[model samples]
Structure formats: C-alpha cells, structure tokens
Target: MSPEPLRSIHVVAGVISDARGRILLARRTEGRDLAGRWEFPGGKREAGETEAEALIRELQEELGITAEIGEPIINVPQQYPDKRLRLDVRRVLSWKGNPRGHEGQALAWVAPEKLPRYVMPPADRPVVAALLHPDRYLVTPSPADVDDETWLGALQRALESGVRRLQLRMPGVDAERRRRLARAAVEASQRAGVEVLINSDIGLARELGAGVHLRAAQLPELSVRPLPDAQPVAASCHTGEELRRAEDLGCDFAALGSVRETASHPGGSVLGWEGFARLREAVSLPIYAIGGLQPDHILEARQHGAQGIAAIRGLWAD
Candidate 1:
C-alpha cells in the first residue's frame, strides 16, 4: 500500500512596518527551514496567544522592537508544491525603536514600489496585489433621479470619462429589476472597457459575472468569497480595523472616507491629512480618500501616500 501523503495546517503571521511606508522583511537564519529566504517578520501563533499578541511577541523577539499591532491587512491561504501551507497574514503598522536583527539575520525597510524587486514567498502574491491598488470606489446610479434609459446613458458617460470601476447600487429595486440593471451595466462597462461591481447582491453579480463590493456593515464575517470571474472585489471602510479586515478578505482595493465633510454621512468626523497619513502607514493596500473629495484634493492625497482619490460627488460634478 502507498504511504499517506503529508498535510499542512493553517498558521497566522504578520507583515510589520512603520510610518514611512516601509515594510520589514527578514532573512531566514542559516540552518533553519527555508534558510536564506526572505519573508515578513512574524512567527506562528502559540496556543492561548491572540493574533495581535503573537505579532507583538514575534517582532520583539526577532527584531528587538516593541510593536503595537494594528488590525490585520491581508489573510492569504497558500499551498506550496513541496509543502502545503495556509498562511493567515496580517499587517502591523505601529512600533517603537529602530528595528535591528536580533537573531543574526539580515533585515531591511523596503518601499512599497520596491517590493516587486525582492523575491518573496508564493503566498505573498495576493498581499502584493492589495498593496498595488489600495483605493476602490463604489459607483451607484441614483434611481430616483434617472430612469432606466437615462441611467444606462449616465453609466456610459461615466465609463467614457475614465470610471473604470463601478458598483451598480440600486438598493430599493426589486430582484428582477436589479438583475436587469446589473446585466446592462456590466454589458455597457464591458463595451466601454470598464469594470462593474454589484453591491451586496452576490447572486445578481454572479449571474451577471460582475465584481462585488461590500458595505462596511457586511465586512466582519464575509462568507461568499469574491467569485473568480470577478477578479477584483472591493469594500467601503470607515476605520483602521475595518480597513485591516477588508485587506484580510483578499479585497482588491478599499475606500476610506469622510476625508472632508459630505452630505451623505452628515456629521461624520473628517480624518484630515494627518489621520489619512497615519492610516496609510498602517497597511500596504492602495487607499483612496473618499467622502467630500474634490479635484484639488487628489494631489494632496497622493502626497500622503494614498494610491489615489475617490469620490461620488467630485467625480460626477460637471
């Protein structure tokens, strides 16, 4: 009889960084598993140790730095041909002390744009993709203002105006109506060479073969993974914790909002440039400054390390 094949179990880890958009990578020590390979600075979670606690401990032990672990950014499960491994990757942004290699291994702070230059584990690919395109927008046609014919025309106009990604968000419409609109939007976007995501209507998005975008409330325990056909799934994020969770869910991009004041979410506090910069340092994803954004704010957002700026009103303005 043939011998039973080996199996692998899931393990949690973190990608540690600082405020300057630099990631900490570790060189595996000589004589250790996967020696000479470079990887994010983290270790396996011990029993009874929370993921945050595990990350804090790993950073201290490996890099001699005291770290304050933030929310998780990306959780990727990968299988190597030689050894099957499921990696639950997190992103840690805050910490103290200049990092030094405590275990006699090499360490470096790499800029996000320079990540591709380094050799990384196969499991880190999705994490890399998230880093490349961090900001996402959810474009919803106003049902009250536009009829079906007008809506399609508006969508076409939006597409021609460089709205590559969109979400068909018609909340009160009936199922059949939503399906019809979603399919139409998908077809129109395809013709215009844009991408369309259906908001919360997974079945319709699947039927129409469109991407999906999750609302902030629906993020904590997402069941349906973004379908393979969609290629990119995005979400709306209001807090650093939520931003981290969205990244963990393998989101292609995310929108962080209320950067300035807006009517949509009245009285919501604006996280000015300082706050945006702080959050930008916490994760490797491409973040967009949402809410009361205008054309002039785009340059400022990019200066703060954001991928770009996203807005419903600003983009639609004449």
Candidate 2:
C-alpha cells in the first residue's frame, strides 16, 4: 500500500544575527509537535502573508521583536511520518527590539561554530550545515579512470582552491590499489584540514579516520549507521525515498542531482533548478546539487535549499 499524500505545511523561519556574529535559536514549548527541539526562531505562515511578512510577523509575535527580513536561504522541504513541511528560512537583516521569548520558550545566541552543540530539530539540521559548511563539494572523477597524475594533481589544485569537503570514488579496483589511493588522498586532504570521504568503503573510512559516502545502491542494505556517530556519512540520493533512507541511516548529508543535463549524460532527465528545489524540500539532510554545475551556481543552490553544488567536472579545472 502507498503512503498517504503528504499535507504540506508552509513555515517561515528566521536566522537572527547580532553584531557579534552570533545566531539565535529557540526551543519549542511543551506540547508542540516538535516540543523541546531547538529551531531557528520563527513560526508558520498565516494565509495571504508573503514570506518576508510572515517571517517578520512570526518574529514579532514569538520573540517580541521587530525584524527586517532579508534574503531567503535554504528553502527546506522536509517530511515527517505524518506530514510534509516547507521551511522557508530567511536571514534577519536588522531588528529594533530586544529578542526575548514571549511564549516562554528559551532563546540563545551562539556562534555559528557552536550550533552543532545544540540539538536542533530534524528539518533544521540541514540549515545548520548550510550555515557552517562549504557550499561546494568535490567528488574526485573516479580516481583510476582519470589516469594516474591527472586526478592526484586535480585533487591538490581543488584543495588549494579552498574546497574543504571532498570524496574519493573508485570502484572495481584491486584492494591494494584502492588502499594506496585512499591513503594518498587522505593524507593530501588532511594537510589542508579538508574533510574527505571514501566512497562505499567502510573499512578504509574507519582505518583512515575519514568519512564514508554510501552509494544509492548501498542504501537498502544498511540497518544502522555504517560509521561512528562523529564520522560523517554522506550518501548519493536521486529520489526523495533515497534521501529519507540517508536520513534514517544517520547520514551527515546527501547529494541530490543531476540538476541539469550534462555532456556525460546527454539527454538524461535533468532535475533543473526547480526540480532540485522540490526534491530538497522533501528531506532534511543537507543536500548538494550535482551534475552539470559550476561555481556560479553556489548562490542559486543555497537559495533553493541546498548546501551547495557538487561536481566531478569543472570543479578542479582552475
């Protein structure tokens, strides 16, 4: 039997900032749907209200503050077991009143780096990731397939370009070869404080203290997290179901794409920008829009609720 159609709940939330560069968070009051969970302080949109208007109203009502809503970022679309949600998160440009919890909920203003210490609601997790993580992800063009030094050189260049997160993907290679390259990649990445993931290899990921990226094919086989809770576990997802699976399996993030047609996969059905936004709204994990993308897409990706863009080509072609 098919699941019931999701009832979409549109919400407008705000990331309020202060002069010291800290962001505000609010805890849900008791008896709410996500009671006790921390969130970017704001509320649902009342009918006939614009997103910015709703945000301003929600902030004034909930926190007894008047805020000027700024640019929208990370327009998240997430689904709970019972209902779906569209969390439109905008940055609060400025405010005139002190932000105090008028509804008895607690509010805290903390540095962005400290956001991970707070236990946020599921839908807000990706928003936090977007706030703290790099917008672009580099998936090494199949290490072996790219020829010996081509990939390694590209790896160094990409890291030098300030790509802080990367993945090394190689398949059907000898164990020894895979180990050699993984070690090299890991070593190269750590020198720059880059977080690297080894594709589909739990043993290698653990041995190297790196993360593991599960392919879509690996999703159905996992019953629990494949790595230590502290280690990042990202997944490749092409559908909402796959994104849900990634979230359920305790993935740190997921990449969803091919956002547009690529030379490599000509005529393949593309998600486009709108399609990416729609799929992104369906899940909470930070998602990177992949396939046929470039540096300029970063801002657009964030606007549509993505951590950023992921790519194999052009990412390293400096």
Candidate 3:
C-alpha cells in the first residue's frame, strides 16, 4: 500500500500578556526550524486536548507560567515552503509566576507598537496587523427618517474624517435598495480611499465590488467563502469561539465587542476594559472593539492590545 499523504493539522497559540499591556513572545531555540525568530508561545494540539488546554500546557511547559486562558482571538492557516500549520491563537489575561525562558530560549515583553521592530515568523505578520488595528467599525443604518442622500452624506463625512474602514449595515432596506446603497457607498469609499464592507450581502457586495462583513448570527451557516477579489472579509464576533470560527474560515479580521454599553444595543452587557483586555489575551486576530466606542477612547483600546477603536458614534463625532 502507498503511504498516506500528510494532512494539515491545527495548533493553538497564546498571545499571553500581563496587566501592563505587554505581549509575551518567545525566541525560537537554536537548531530548530525558524530558529532566532520571535513568536507567540504555543505548540501543536495533542489528541483529546482542547485548544485552550493545549495553550495552557504549552505555556506551563515552555515558559514556566500558569496561564489563565481567556477567549480565543484568531486562527491563522499558513503554508510555508517547508510545512503547513494552522495557528489557533488566544489571549491570556491573567497568569501565575513571572514568565521565564524554561526552554533555554529568550523571552521578551513587547508593546504592540514595538512589534514591528522584532524579527518574527512570517505567519505572524497578519497577527501584527491585527494587533495594530484591532477594532473594526460596524456602521448601522440611521433611522428610517434619514433619507438616502443624508445617509450617503453621513458616510462621506465619516470617511473624510479618517474612518478608514466601515460596514454598511442597512438590514431593513430591500434587496434593490440595498444594492443601490451598496453601490453608492462603494463609490464614496473608493473616492475617499476608504474600505467598505457590506453586511451579509455577498452577492450584492460582489456586484458592487465591495467587501463583505458577516454578522455573528450568519457565521455558523457561511458555506460560501467571501469573494477573493474583495481583499478583506470581516466578521462580528461576540465571543472567543466565534472569533476562532471567523479566522478559521479565512476572514481577514473580526470585530469583537460591546466593549462598552451603547444605545444601539442597550441590553447588551458591557465588557468593560477589564473584560476587553481578557478577550484580547486570548486571540491573535486583529479585534476591533465595537459597541459604544468614542474617538477619545482609541488610545485606551490600543492600550488594551486592540488594533484600534471602531465605533459608529465616535468615528462620526465632530
């Protein structure tokens, strides 16, 4: 019998950090593959071990720290010339014992902004982008009283004011209306060099030559991949599991939130800074803090290890 082909496997990673907002990275040991490169600490998943459990074990064995794993952040599927690996990364918020290089390698505490300065594994570039600009803006449509012209004007104004990314979320609009609006938004965003993601309208987004943003409700049923031509596909993830699914499905980014309470979803529980930080420790995907974000809070979001702050109100604030 012929030998079986090697199958791709999944592995979990830990983007472990402390309360001071420094990420823990390990230098690969000499003589190992990709030696001298810095990477988020983690290893392959052992049979019957959950992703979280694998991360905890990796941290304890490799760094001598007891990791209190939080929610997952991102799963990166990377194929190198030598090997293929799926990196399931999570955020680690709390842990016991100061991390030491138990594997006889070096460790460092790096701020997100300083990540670019270090030499890291090639698979970590997207992770770096996510860390730098974590938050994503989910732009809900204005009230019915707002006309198409007014909505376009609002979007235009927001784009001009430096809202680099947005999701056009007019769910109540009929299909025809949605297509027209998507076209208009795409035009405006192209003119201003901004990116627009149409909420849950893959076909319409394709027709309009725009990106797609998947809502959490639609995540489980996403059978078709977002069109590759769109460049970036994003998702709204309320929990670690959802974020993992989004990343596993090849989404370029995800919006994780209700970091703060807001009028948009009044009943949604606020995951304050502490909660947001906890989630941050779990994943390596770029997470944009959604729900109740304001412009002034951008720095605070960054401090918590988010890519950036994403907001409906704050991005539009005058």
Candidate 4:
C-alpha cells in the first residue's frame, strides 16, 4: 500500500545575500531533524504570521540580524517520511547587522556557483539551482526539416532574447553532421552569453567545453558524474526514482514532464498541472516543466514549485 499523505508545516526561509553575490547558509543545531546539515536560514511561521513577518522574525532570532524580506520567490513542498515541509523561500534583498549564528550554529557566506560543494538537506537543493539560474531553459527541436542557416538564425534570435540555458538535441543525423551542428550552436550561444548542453552526448559536450544532459535511461548505468565539477550536468527525469538517481549522480538540474501536450509528441500522455506539482514535491532539484509549456506558464509553473519552464517549440517559435 502507498504511504499516507504528509501534513505540511509551513516554514519560511531566506536566501540572504551580500554585496559580493554571496548567499548565507546556517548549520542546523544538535536537536533538529538532519542536524549539522546546512540550509538557508529561517524558521516556522507562528500563528497568524505573514510570510514576510515570519521570515524577518526568524532571521532576527536565528542569525542575529534584521532582514528585509522581498516578495516570496518560491515555495518548496517536500515529504520527509515522518512529516511534510512547505519551505516558503524568499529573497532577502537587504539587511542590517552582521549575520551571526545566534543559536550557536555554524554559518558561511558562499558564492552561488560554489554552493553545490557544500552538503545540504534534500530540500535545499533546488534553491541552489534557482539562485544561480533565474531564467527559462531552451531546447532546440529536431533541425532535420529546416535548413542549417534558418535553424541557426532562429536559435541565435532566441539566445539574443535572454534564453540563457539551452539544450541542443538533433536526432536522425549522421555523426559528422551532428558535430558540425553542435559546434555551430555552441559558437552562437557563447557569443550571447548562454550556456549550452548536448543531449546525451558526453564526449561531444566535453569536446565543446559544454555540458551534458543525460537521458533518463543513462542515469542507472553511471556510477559517477559524467562531467567534471567545473562543468554542468543535467538530466531528464520522469518519476521519483529518476529524480533520486539524478541526485545520487550529482546532476545540476532536471527537465521533468510532459506537463502538457505538444506538437512534437502529438496526443502524448500529459501530466497536467496537478500531476506536475505532485512529482515536483518529491525532489529537491530544480525542475523545468517540459511537454507543452510556453513563456506564459512560467509564473504558474513556479507556483507549483518548478524552477522554470523548459520548452522546445514554445521557445523556438518565440
């Protein structure tokens, strides 16, 4: 039988930053669940407390600083077997006083890219990805039908529009043609300051000084991360098991779903918004809702805990 649904306890957290782009993290005390693990500093909401109120209060008590909470950035709902936690995280845009571990816990101000080096509780994982990347992910559809010039032009235009993260996937091409396309795409992306990943091609990604995006089937066979820590590694995940594997393998982010129908996969089984939320709640990694999402669904997707939306046709057409 399936486990019973966990009752959520609302907790407010803050991603406090300093002038040098460093985020503050605190170690849990001796008596809490997952103690000694590092996490974004904040605490549970008291009776009738608003999110901002609770966040500010928690920061003052725990960090010995007066925090100015910005609008709620993201809400993370996680199941911990014994309990469920809804971590309502916000950006602490500014604050007063030097942040200290008033509760006698350890504290660190870490660079955003170096956050992955520190071990954290499961729930804090996604927040790291969200901090570093606050933009949509673009996936290029098959370029076989379109001419090379036309395809590259469309991709360059999209990159110019601030699509910072991209995955280039072109199937049914000869190995030589694929490499040529990959090289061209990476060149175009670099000029616009975008990070590029190759779909399930480890060697090619390495050769291009790019990243690798693993297909779900690739997760189980790998015992170690495919790329060096300096590079990014992403995965395509569908279920809780896949997500867990992605974490174990040390992926940077995941593109999850068929959250809605799309022309690419006509009449495909769709996860819908609610199904997407259920799957999202199961893991801590940043997820980009795939399947048929457009730019407009970004807010709604984030509302359900996705970091951002990842699209093929949606991004290409736009």
**Candidate with best TM-score:** 4
Which lDDT value does model 1 have at 51? 78
lDDT of 3 by residue, 214-267 (tens): 889888887656779445788888887887788777787778788888997788
User: How does each model score on lDDT?
Assistant: 0.69, 0.87, 0.75, 0.86
At residue 83, what lDDT does model 3 achieve? 55
Tell me how candidate 3 scores on lDDT: 0.75
**Candidate order by TM-score, highest to lowest?**
4, 2, 3, 1
User: How much is the lDDT of residue 169 in candidate 3?
Assistant: 82
**Candidate 4: tens digits of C-alpha lDDT, residues 1-318:** 997776778889999888898888999889998998999999999999999999999999998888878876777777787777888889998898989888999999998889988889877877777777854899998888887888888888888777899999998888988899999999888888888999999999999999999999999999999999877899998887898899889898898898988886899888887887788777787888888888998878876778889988778853
lDDT of 2 by residue, 193-242 (tens): 99999999888899999999999999999999999976899999999899
Candidate 1 C-alpha lDDT tens digits along 1-318: 995664665456567666787877878888976688777787777779887787788788888888776655555444444554545566666678878888898988888788767776655554565565423443664665567887777667777777766777787777777678778889988787677778876666777777887888888868555667345677888788888788778776777776888887788798987677666544555666787876677656655555556776666523
Give the range of the ten consecutive residues with the poorest summed lDDT in model 2.
142-151
Return the TM-score for candidate 2, rounded to 2 decimals: 0.88
Screening candidate 4 with a backbone cut-off below 3 angstroms (N, C-alpha, C), the clashing residue pairs are none
TM-score, model 1 to reference: 0.58
lDDT (C-alpha) at residue 156 in model 3: 76
Give the Cα error of residue 19 in candidate 2, in Å: 4.0
